[model samples]
Target: MTIDRPRSALMAVLLAALPAGCTPVATVGPSRPPLAVRGSTATVEIAPVLLAARDHFPDGAEVRNGGIPNLVGAAPVEGLGGGGAADVATHAETQALRYSVAHPDIRIILTVTEGLYRIVARRSAGIASVADLKGKRIAAIPTTSSGYFLARMLASQGLGLDDVEVVRVSPIETMAKELADRKVDAVAIWEPHADNALRALGTDAIELSGTSIYRERFNLNSTAAALADPARRARIVRFVRAVLAATAAIERDPRPAQALVAATGGFTADEVGRSWPHLAFPATLPGDLVDLLVDEEAWLAAQEKRPARERGELAKLIDSSVLEEALAPPR
Candidate 1:
């Protein structure tokens, strides 16, 4: 898929550990399929990648609406699939576990952005701190990163997920409304939905974030076959470089990027503005990505009732050379 450009909170995540990286462009080859890409149009996390595809891309790639699931067909279409048209895709690391094992060709080349999730609780629900979430109804999508974040957050407070009722929220766009209507007392999710919940609650809102526990690594992914081909690799590198440049533009002034996201994701300007700080456009591979994956595998493994993989196997899923070439010194 063609890439797109791609958060904030009360505690604010420490993404300084996620470094700024660069890359240069290459000309696309004349080929079949037009080199389409798949990613989530509804997610603000992928705005930069979307922008890159629209504004950059020498040969221009199709920015299909899907995610990592689109890159590989191992998982169901629930996540927005990559299929045959998806030469590239963007998704969080958790999704990688499900499809990466079955499809060994998949690899994460760059972390386009980071999702600093937060728990937006209704202060009226007798919750004002992370510790107060016990026995409360918390909305988080199960079998995904959001649920993992909920578990991690609760563990920090000496509580387990069993201590509270985990309410399932669908359409994800409804997460804010679910909490605001008191159907769920809290929501641990990605922005701008998390920020939407906070604003909905207003005086009743209590936001608790900032944890070393977990920050979703939303990355750019491609198959080994695509990268191994000279023509396709050249096109991929150019797309990656475009993504990095788009991120730089985002970090400088998010207004234009916000407008794009608001229009694409159907988010209001205030929602985009409020949630902007929650995201970090590192665009570089985070040093601890594999470590994060290893730590997270067990949770996903348990969810799917499968054995977790070793660190080495997970490491193979990330290929840094593309970003390195992109970040290489200009000759």
Candidate 2:
């Protein structure tokens, strides 16, 4: 995919402005076959990874590809797999667990990506904070991914969904068009989308600001369901190890990741590369962020569009032990 020039320059400036030595780029290497034993069973969101796994493990390995744009589709996939949905959306793990209550066998395995949140409004609009969004029509999707982030921003200024007119747009690219046409007054989107969207409007046309709101309140992740049989869980954990390894490879060298995501029709290398500076390439879950899921769960529960949920019940749904052990060196 073609890279956006103006946006690229802007990102360059912002990346430079970041605290010294905070480069988010990970050095990636050439793709190869699965390092772990083949024939493992696990579900993943990114289709490219599944395809790559097939290339890497062209043997008896069986991978269940079950990525949905929203958290809703992940539930059924998780149920069938005997685990809850491993959410691809930010802050979605807890919400997926709430879905697992009825389907007790399901659990969540998260593949976390790093990204930064930018609150954008038309340039010269002088909109410096979330408080300025009051009554403005903003474009975005409400997902487990962005739920907590947006809520925290709004709550930081005593605002809620009611404070602004939320225009439902599927992806950030689409939202960019609406914002460019003035159909929406503002938008909250992560990198790549934020970068791509800003390019459509011309860098000067949009004012950008970053906040801890997302890291402070939002969590983006992928999950695999938990299995009842300990042995099966063990297998799933092994799969998790492979997944983490792949993620690390991507983080180390995003070129492959950029290529993979582009091939999957998600975003381009330019977009991913631009987003790279703003995103985290961590190999582990943020416990603090995970702990904050309770608040996010509570907020989602209040929304009519969201599934019902119980307080503090989200913690039980996350089974990271497999991931923990998998990351440990082989005995």
Candidate 3:
């Protein structure tokens, strides 16, 4: 939770560089309950974008920030109800699928964004492509989406985790630092950290695009109890609507949204601007979400030596009714 000095200084500089009339800090609207919303500190997921678009939220809907290092364990999901958090956002679709499998009480209500993850390497490391990763030290945040990205990237070239030296890093900031310091040959990560690594290494950075191997889907997940409760469901619907509106706002004019992300994420405006094109802010759930989950589940089961889930069983993990209703014409 502690912001490092270098990051703190970068945030300060970025904030000061904003246009004269821009707000210095990201804000959220008032709340009815401490709506526990979990988001990662490194990715520009829906929750942070909503926080950045504070004015688009429903009146009196307060959002409590529950930013975490990553969404690998059940702790963040359990915190939605057990830890007094109402909603959580996950950067990886696989995590949401995993949560639904582990906790039958949780449902993936909405998918807010999608993007292409990348593997950044030093050009001098001879890692020009995924095929070059064998025996090389690759830094990644374990148990998060980055891990999945690494796996897929390797698998694309007939490789696996065993094909490379997996160097575990956390909180994302270290991933960038390690790659820049030459402590690792490559980093499999998501933005804005991936973007940060590229900037840090500059001419030395070589990005291995995973567009062919991986595409990320970030979702808003909630406990069954929250979905079952009328008041909480209504609030969640409103939250989704606000996120949809915020997505439209960003599409229309991204400067304010980028500024807010830079301020809150400890990223420079240039970094956000450079990374923006890779992200797609969509409010609705994808029609092929179940297929994607099934594919990921198969990949995971194979990798972990676990039982693969049936299509019918995996289909239950997604509940698009909320999204459908939210996007419906007002009665």
Candidate 4:
């Protein structure tokens, strides 16, 4: 039976109200949305999830373009199959609170930080350290991991975005060139692009040291209703397992993962190799996940012009059961 528009709205309302671990009755066939993972082809971050879908996942999974916003917004928003949102999506933790405000049920299930995120700056710009970034123009994608990273890095050295000219460059992949051409002094960005910046500037390019300052907690997210649905949840778990397996494979022998990313033609083999090491695959959820969220919430809330939610409130966004089960030993 086709679900009428009225029933569909009602179902959405009902699903939104359900607890994070609860779901309506199981339904199959065309009415149910096909299980799909969503992410961006633009960044090197999505490679592990891509590998999982391509090799390890039992279901025929394919990654579509988009991120947390598309995942949290009801379908018709992102055009995921069967008029539903992506069951699982990949993005940085920075995206969580912004989207979760409307869809409080969004849960971060896995830490997808296959590597470290960074800031590429020009040595000619007198940028020897993170502190020197003050008063210089830096390009960053707003409300993204890269943006949040800029904030954290600056704050670490008693600087804020106010202290620097934060430039938002179009076709963010061009950020590297921007720095090399001196259009911007520095850029806080994810891999491949960060690698591109280094390549664009070569000896003139300096990656500011901030291993202790910040790292992108790129993650896999799903809705409460999806997690609550047994079948959907199982598929999601399987995909997480696949992601972990893929991470292990990438860790053991990155050439395969590098080839996979190269196969997409987004980045050259060298770009992937240089940037790939910057990422460390810790398949498990980080213990600092909630701590990071609580700290980042203030910045996100201020940026959105809203009051930050309580710490406990932010804590609800993580659902570790999926990771736990994914790592659990066979019975």
Candidate 3: RMSD over Cα atoms? 4.3
Score candidate 3 by TM-score against the native: 0.84
lDDT of 2 by residue, 17-109 (tens): 434533233222345222221110111124224323432222222323233323344333321222223323333353454455444333444
Residues 1-331 of candidate 1: C-alpha lDDT, one tens digit per residue: 3333222221122122212322112234556545677878778888898667655666766776677776666543663533555778888887776687688688999999899888899988998788898889999987778988998898888998889999888878888888888899999889988888988899999889855678989989998888999888887888898898888887777766776666555566677788878988889999999988888888788777888999888899999999988777644
Alpha carbon deviation, residue 114, candidate 2 (Å): 3.3
Best by lDDT: 1
**Span of ten consecutive residues with least summed lDDT in model 3:** 63-72
Question: Which sections of candidate 1 miss by over 4 Å?
Answer: 1-33, 74-76, 79-84, 329-331
Query: Roughly what TM-score does model 2 have, to 2 decimal places?
Result: 0.68
- Candidate 4 C-alpha error for residue 74, in Å: 5.6
List, residue by residue over 1-331, the lDDT tens digit for candidate 4: 0111123444455445434533322233554554566766556777787667666765656466666766766543222223336788877788777789888999999998744767889999998998899899999987677788889899988888899998999777689888888899998887878878888998998887567877778889998888999999888998899998999988887766666555442455677788777887788889888888988899999999999999899888999999988888845
Off by over 4 Å in 4: 1-34, 74-84
TM-score of each: 0.87, 0.68, 0.84, 0.85
For model 3, residues 1-331, the per-residue Cα lDDT tens digits are 1111224666677768767755432343343433445554445664334443355653333333342212224464322222334454444677665555566566777777787789899988987878999999998855667788888889888999998999987546778888888999998887877888888899998889988777788877776667778887776777777777777777788877777667656666677788887787776788888888888888777766789989988887778878877787756
Sliding window of 10 residues with minimal summed lDDT for model 2 = 35-44
Which residue runs does candidate 2 get wrong by more than 4 Å? 1-65, 68-91, 94-98, 101-105, 124-126, 205-211, 216-226, 305-312
